[model samples]
Target chain A: MLRSWRWAAVAAGVAALVSLPTLAGALPTRSSDVTAEELRDLVRASGAVAHEAYGESRVDLPLPDVDALGDVPELLGSTTRTRTAWRTPLDWRVDRLTVAGETDVVRAGALTTTWDSADRSVTRLLGDLPVRLPRADDLTAPVLARRLVATPDTVLSRLPERRVAGRSAPGLRVAPADPAQTLVESVDVWVEPGSGLPLRVEVRADGQRNPVVTAVVLDLELGDPGARRTAFDPPPGSTETTTQAPDVAAEVDRLVPFLLPNVLAGDGRADPAGLGTGGVAVYDRGFEAYAVVPLDRDLGGDLLELAPPGGVFATPLVTVLVGRVERTAYVLVGTVPEQVLRDALTALRRDPPPFVGDR
Target chain B: MILTELAKLVRRPRTWVLVALLCALPTVVAVFVAVQEIAPRPGTGPAFLSAVLDSGTLFPAAALAIVLPLFLPVAVAVVAGESVAGEAQAGTLRYLLLRPVGRTRLLVAKLVSTLAFTLLSVSFVALTAYAVGVALFGSAEVSSVSGTEFSTADATVRIVLTVLYVGWSMLGVASVALFLSTLTDSPLVAALGAVGVLVASTLLVTLEAAAAVQPYLPTRYWLAFIDLYRDPVLTRDLLRGVGLQAVYIGVFLAAAWANFTTKDVTS
Candidate 1:
């Protein structure tokens, strides 16, 4: 009987030992000697390395109900789980997992392949998409880190070591040097010490209790998946279609009648996405930056007229403004204060910047 | 003694009935999907069901998903819950103990038999689903969820891994039921008690308010086997699920042994 009791104790002890390492990792560890500048450089260099990761990204941005937007609103307002094999921004694959099935968007060289599991079809699009909505790809740790650092006046500081993605990664905090310029409170990033990869990122918009966005790498490997792995090899019984995507920059530059200002409010015009195209423009040098879309006069006007909550929809973290300035109707969206959007709309309606526009 | 217990379990009519019920569900679903020629829109129904029509190779995976949430766990709970309790209720356990079978050995035999039942039931369901799927839709091309074609051999490997994962998860349920079986002579009460834990775990797992304790819940990573179909098989959740189930199996089996070996044998 006593031996049986000892056996029970032994079993319980083994269970405790199994849990000990995970519990110990939660305890605060010593901070690394890396500086903020060095971490920034590391993150930038990490972008050049070929690697793959699987992670879950969460966005708490509340989207307004709009008929014109289809599913874009729901897509931006929920958690996105993905597995990525990235060689470069132009050549990568993101497999989005959902309860229904997996949809893979693979970019090989100049063509992007979207494989739909339901239809058993592959659609390949040619050329880079000049301007696109935020996607699962944009919410990953490394991609988000690079975007955060692109903000002109962000100040970086060293933070204590934190465990993420099953590894101890040193932390770096990035905030705007001038607080009044952006809506972002701070961006916290944890880096893989060896590869310099950003393993986790948490973004807190101003005045929000919870981080507005969080993207963390749950599993990672630091080697190229190779060209063969990156290539789109459609299996048997799968239908394939290839379509040429119109050059958005050239089309927008040639078609639109009006112009977006070179600068809006106190912020300068900078397109971090490099969408230097004419009709589509993103303003501001900070996180408070707003995007300007030159919609066709009739569709833009009708959408602005039908927008709910009095032709302006606002979430705690994001704001959208739509208004008509004569024949050229515009939709302005940003994370800045509502006043900034109004001012940008007013500027679009009023004095237009002549920064290299032919029209 | 373990072999005897397993033979006794295999001889029971209830075991075959449970296995039949588990397989019937996926067969019925495959029939409807085949006859209608309309699979659930991507991301609407069970995980792999949407793609099963596209590639019948996913049928076993889809079948696992169909029964995993409720049927398999309930079946495991019922058999394990009846293991020791049924013997006690029938007044055979005390006599068997008197016949010189060690208390710890009896408990070990009972646990092994329950594990065998889990394995038997899960594999039977997979085998049935594979036949139904291949016959109805045909497995000319085996495509993974990530749009890559898996060789027939590779597909079989994934199905095998899924079977092992589902079996391991069912073992967690069996341990809970077996522990309850040792606590009471009433088989029904033991089975109900085991199932109650699963029901509560499932309910709490889906509740956002229960987030703090969700990770520790038994069913937290139950469906993680679906991650195996991913292009580069995601093993993080699989490893965690295995570890969590191991902890549950360890703690509960120890408790059952501690109680059974020392408890008064009034029956």
Candidate 2:
């Protein structure tokens, strides 16, 4: 019995040592307390730094219910491991799930090429650099950092210093400067102090103690990425097709003159004097900017399915207003409320674009 | 020699008229926006036009955009085309060459004067637009199309960078005109030919079938100065544009030198 106890004790000691890094990483380390003013400055400075920093990491996204989400073309599943270099003509790779092995998507410059190892086929999309808004599941850190920079006034609280992806980081909990205007209650980010890059981000919905959406960088590397050649090339024997991005401005321009004038005519909110109307009308109210695009009815596939006829779909960070007016399909996307989007849509319908024929 | 040539170039009535005309475009745009009930959508005409509508102070950028594609390049062409050809047509080239000045030095002086005009014309448009825009619109933080807001100081720096880039890009047009000027004694023909080549390049770049040749077109990256306003300051296109301009300057200037040196100066 004494020998058995000795063996058990030895095994337990070994196990504790193996787990130490993971266990201790979450615990608070040495961190200096920061004032609100300093935090604000840090947020401002974060924008310039965030754009300069580049690395690859394993990312776990918070995906809402798929039935409610519908067909999200840019969706990268709930858990994704992507390698990204965020410079001009950005380069990135996402390991996609497939039966015959992991398919890979690499975007270099303006081309996003995907290699399907299972079928031995490759797909290429030639358009603008593949970029998406910071949602719960997609590019989180940069988006969160951008929001922090844009939000001049925020309620900030310092948290314990923690280690993320082997790097020492400090945490800050931020709430909107005007809580009444926003859907987000608080956003907590673990920032790598040396680089001013967010290592992890957790967004809490209004009145929620637990975060509704969280993104943690499983592995991250900062500084020079060296020569990365593979992320830029498409596989051999793969057919490629180039698709042009929809000219949103031109599409809007084409539809604006034909739009029923004063569809939003009487509303004082549709202030013609200040707001120049395009095919897309963007409303910016600090920390939140949304664009109202009136596309063709056929282009409203996923958006229409996500909401009931002319209904709104409220995601954690984005609220999308979808509806059809005659042959034109209108989609309003932003961080604003469902009502605000709807109001803007109404205003758009009533008013002719600020300058209809001037373009 | 360069300073004297520049003074002589500046003394010409047409140079002042060209500068004044370039300056007037932005004033017209400013007045139209201010007086009209309608305003243009953002990201429409020029890079910063929409922003200028928001804050009249951004008129400098709007003016730069207005002038870069046509007015500025044309003004540059007029001066550059007249550099060698006008003197040759007027029989002053032979007299100038008879002096102790080398043919190379005279050519260099003429080129320098033309470049000086390019810089002055661009600067005049930008400064005039700034004044007019500030008078009417009032200065404010300039918002970039890339969704980044810049402080007035940062915006001013970007505007200066943009002006420099525009001036540099115009060197290609100027060099072409200078080369043409060396070929002909008719300043009008040289100017028209240079402007016509630029127009052709612009037209070719707009065609989808011209994709292979698009990268080599002189006008392909003219408007790429907009990339400087991006959050990270996208340098791929800017660098390419600058490199292209540099190549144009080197080749055309060499051609002008080679032709000018060997040509008979009986005129």
Which candidate should be chosen as best, given lDDT against the real structure?
Answer: 1
- Candidate number of the best TM-score: 1
Candidate 2 at residue A151, lDDT? 59
RMSD of 2: 24.0
Model 1 steric clash pairs: A100-B43
For residues A260-317, write the lDDT of model 1, one tens digit per residue. 5566665576643224445677786667677777776566766766777645777766
lDDT of 2 by residue, B43-124 (tens): 2466566555457766787788788878888889989999999999999999988889987788899889988888888888
Error of 2 at A249 (Å): 19
Q: Return the top candidate by DockQ.
A: 1
lDDT of 2 by residue, A171-286 (tens): 88877777665666777777767666677777776765556556565555555343352344433433455533223344443345432233342222221322333355455544
- TM-score computed on alpha carbons, candidate 2: 0.48
DockQ of each: 0.48, 0.00
| DockQ category of candidate 2 | incorrect
After superposition, candidate 1 runs with Cα above 4 Å error: A1-22, A27-30, A65-75, A88-90, A243-258, A263-268, A271-278, A294-307, A324-330, A349-359, B208-212
DockQ of 1: 0.48
